[model samples]
Target chain A: MKQTQTLNHPLDDLLRTDRIPHIWCPGCGIGTAFSACLIAMKESGINLAKTAMVSGIGCSGRGAGYVKLDSYHTTHGRAIPFATGLKLANPELNVVVFSGDGDLFAIGGNHFIHAARRNMDLTVVCVNNFNYGMTGGQAAATTPHLARTTTTPMGNPEMPFNLPLLAWASGATYVARWTILHARDLAESIEEALQRRGFSFIEVLSPCPVNYGRRNKMKPMDTLRIFKEKTLIKNNAQPTELGIDFERGIVLGKFVDEDKPSCGELYDKTCRPSLTQGTAA
Target chain B: MEPAVLTGEHYMTGDEACAEGALAAGCRFFGGYPITPATEIAETMAARLPKVGGTFIQMEDEIAAMAAVVGASCGGVKSMTATSGPGFSLMMENLGLGICLETPCVVVNVQRAGPSTGLPTMAAQGDMMQARWGSHGHYEIIALSPSSAQEAFYQTILAFNLAEKYRTPVLIMTDEVVGHMSERVVIPEAKAIKIVERTRPRGRKDRYNPFEPGEFGVPPMASAGEGYNVHMTGLTHDERGYPDMSVECQEQMVNRLVGKIRNNLDDIIRTESHRLEDAEVVVVSYGVSTRTAYAAVEEARELGIKAGMLKLVTVWPFPERQIRELAGRVKGFVTVEINLGQIHLEVSRCAAGLAPALLVGHCGGTLISPEAVIEAVRRIV
Candidate 1:
């Protein structure tokens, strides 16, 4: 493996090479999803100097630590608000929040909703592995009903969040869903979000071979087979119809893409220069 | 550009004065949720920030408010957030994040009565100890308490300066009485008001370590978009600003984080004395209670008790040496506040049995009257 790891990789400039050998377990999908994001960022043509990454706590939250850009590894469940402040203050920077389902949905669910409702100018990427992969796979808000987790050996009894639907209902300007198996498509969707204005959300379904797959009696290859056989690509699909299904067919596509003024744009147009004029630095 | 500072005497509530002070201090970002007694500050900022080309956001909650403040500040803008008790409790976790990241920002807690939202609109000096120890770790914090609206304006600016100077969260711990009470606050001219910006990296960008200290043990802060590729985390990080999991790394990081404030006690701490010379008794107080303590000290002096009051301007460094020295000279101390003896307990500990430290404390929603303070002084004397 070390021999194959050459002195230069195409993505080396985008990575903190010194922080190599990341903490992700074998066959974990976060690495694939995170690299997809980095690829999107690199190809977006936006200034990397004016881009910042914000992450909350979890396995995927460690994504910010490996990036060779300005990043904030903030407190648990606070990545969006932190990114909001960064964007609003500078307005010139492209802020991205990359984190896990447990961090972004279960704990940070409120912030995600409000940020979307206000149309905060941010690109939020949620790596959904069905369970909390960082803590040996506990049941999470995105865990499919009947899925086995450490905390739910009998199977998760509740329904998981339909992320695409939630993002759509909460007023996301762009909403899409994809599996790690669709790496190219996911990266393209993110690139599109980077080029767009207002709130954008992309949910990436990933495999947790060491945690979720093992308990569910599914290997990494088995999950990959599911992603290959059990999913359908349907562009412009209705968001409400988007939900996870491994045995049954799963619909994957871009559900919402529209134009509206971001919160900052509206604030500037309505609230600026009227009260006291431009503030002296 | 419009003048950020309104230089003239104007009668305004302490909350409005605090918002104005933030403007004068170069705070261009205000992210907060509306809580009673502190809501006016947010209202003012929402109206005024954009006019100055600054940004103001009313976040979803106090946790979001604090996260936004820290984020904006890390983006290289002077930022702050105002809230009361319930909101303050929600912000404690992120406050620790700010401390560990050494992100400088001001947190204004215009305190209202609360064990659990006790008296939403009533004044209380109850969050004193909370401001110091509310966050989970053992760290020294800079906190200021203002007794009047005029002081509120000045202290808010001072809070920003100290935050920038020390690279730590500076808390303004005022009470509802001062927050809502109208008073004449004399604002200095725009160019006359002092502002301190965080030290930024000056040399080779690639070699600059975000956590490596420069002058005054404060590391040069590189904002997010500075091309420094700076990585700031709430984790225990090395000078390179990457997480280090070793025990030695934790010790070094935590120590430097705490020692920066502990070693500069003199520069950060402030206390004002009123007629304490030759006094047999001293009244220790801060925030709204300091106003009552002044009146009580005069009353005790009229009774030939040789009394005086020590007003705590910066409450968190706690002025321990002052308390210890006065414990030696003064016969006793009377700590007056609108709490169940929070500040009084600190005085008692520093007194160390050298003199009696009697408490004139109460629950929130009401002020500690001067008579009650005088009675406590009489007992202690």
Candidate 2:
């Protein structure tokens, strides 16, 4: 294989340069989310060789394919369980899951709740582009009411999920949300989440340039601009105060921050007897 | 002849025996959920494994359970999971992944009646065929069936050995009857029991490919972060473990996987034959049903009907040579099982043009009695 040096940074070198000039269109928010994750890995001091990136089926799921880490392109909505296995297998290795809104919320919704409830030591980075970008912009569980998509040409009738709140209630030790426009802060939050020793969820409000943009009459750039203007960030805002509206995105910040026993740590303490006895030699 | 001398004795159910077998085999990790008949396996592991300094985790579902076992195996621990029919179905996809990735692990399916939740508490061998082909695609499996608590323990140890040696998933196909029934089984010392570990690479780490075939067609396995960049997937992968969907790659990969077990047939396939030398007829069976077949064969002998018994200890890589040899001499064959004639088809195919083969089977629960098997044998004879 011919090796070429593109960007001098190690993160850029880790990327699949041959496949890039990425499939993501201009002004797509997925690129920002991907960049933030790369920066977070770089900042966390996690050895890239010791990291495994698991992703479900979607555009953001393609993140695993791009990273040079030992990655798994798992089945749709099954990244959490797969990552959970990897983390529990060797608690020393850093395991992260990258998924899209529809893949995580609609199809893998049960896994999301259960993973958080167990407080598994994993970092979940979900790119919420409002609709299923890969499937031509169908209405997603994260799509706000009144948003237009292929499934809801008139308007989305179902209520959008407050993902961070759900994670917080599900016993996630660390939870945060940010739009693609806030790349630096999102990267910082991801770093914090990765370092945190429990279930950590970071929801990135990415823009689906093709399906979500064309149907909503907002161009990719306009979506990012709207997210920048509409989002309200409060350091300590109550769940009731951070209400959801299409016109005004709720307070986006580190929503829940607490220390709790991670599943891996608890399991280690409880399960040590068997392992120690069998492999003590 | 006098009955075979046996040693070691403890009152325990088959599920508990299986757990002890795992512990004796040096299994340090167990990931499973609580399911009827199979729950004892997990509960025992949770209590005993922790006492032994091993790890036990109750995953949210069987999918995660199977995945965790595979993960633990890759991390250089002998790991296992136990479940019943519905949970077994949930594990099929990951089981296939384990096969493709060449991860060594054991899955204990305590058989229960099921088309869809048929009888959760009742015993059945309905999953006999599923044990072989439930996972999509062609791959070899080592499945062992036990008739009693003692065999459950010994077979579980054998299952782990086969899994490690073959670098494949070994299925312990026990049923609710055996899983729930309590019997005396003496636990063996670890030093007395045989153990097999995967061969590790010798030379430079950079030159090592995880899936590159060794002398036995099984590659050396190095765990994650062991400075070995191993790439594994459910897809048909090449020697380097990259997904190669081409015809040639698929041919090579599939052939190697199947060939590993096929070429080592003598070592992989095991069976027990009773009074076969001058017998005119043979009764073949496995699992709990084998006990019935043995009694019936003895009854036929008492009636001066030249009858013998062939008990299949290893189900898959299906004892073809032994079946062929036994078929050549026996006048006819009677195969019995708990399921409705699954393994009978294999017996028929193996005995094709040699003799008539009859199936004595029952669905839903327990084994068909010795009388039922005797009736089938009389008709065939």
Q: Which candidate wins on TM-score?
A: 1
How much TM-score does chain B earn in each model? 0.99, 0.96
**TM-score of model 1 relative to the true fold?**
0.98
Writing each residue's lDDT as its tens digit, candidate 2 over B1-381 gives 111112257899999999888888878789898899799999988877766656688887887788778767766678899999999999998888788878889999999998888899999988989999999998888899999999999999899999989899899999999999999898755567888887777789767788888877888887766766565656677886766779999999999999888888888888988888887888898888888888998898898888888999998879877778878878888998887788999999999999899989877666688998888878877
Model 2 spans > 4 angstroms off: A1-9, A12-28, A47-49, A133-139, A146-156, A239-245, A268-281, B1-8, B245-247
Q: Give me the runs in candidate 1 sitting further than 4 Å from their true place.
A: A1-7, A273-281
Per residue, candidate 1 scores C-alpha lDDT tens digits across B267-333 of: 9999999998888899999998898999999888889889988999999988999999999999999
lDDT of 2 at B89: 97
Instruction: Enumerate clash totals for all models, in the order shown.
Output: 2, 10
lDDT of 2 by residue, A127-210 (tens): 998888877889989888888999998899888998887887788888888888899989999999888888999999887778
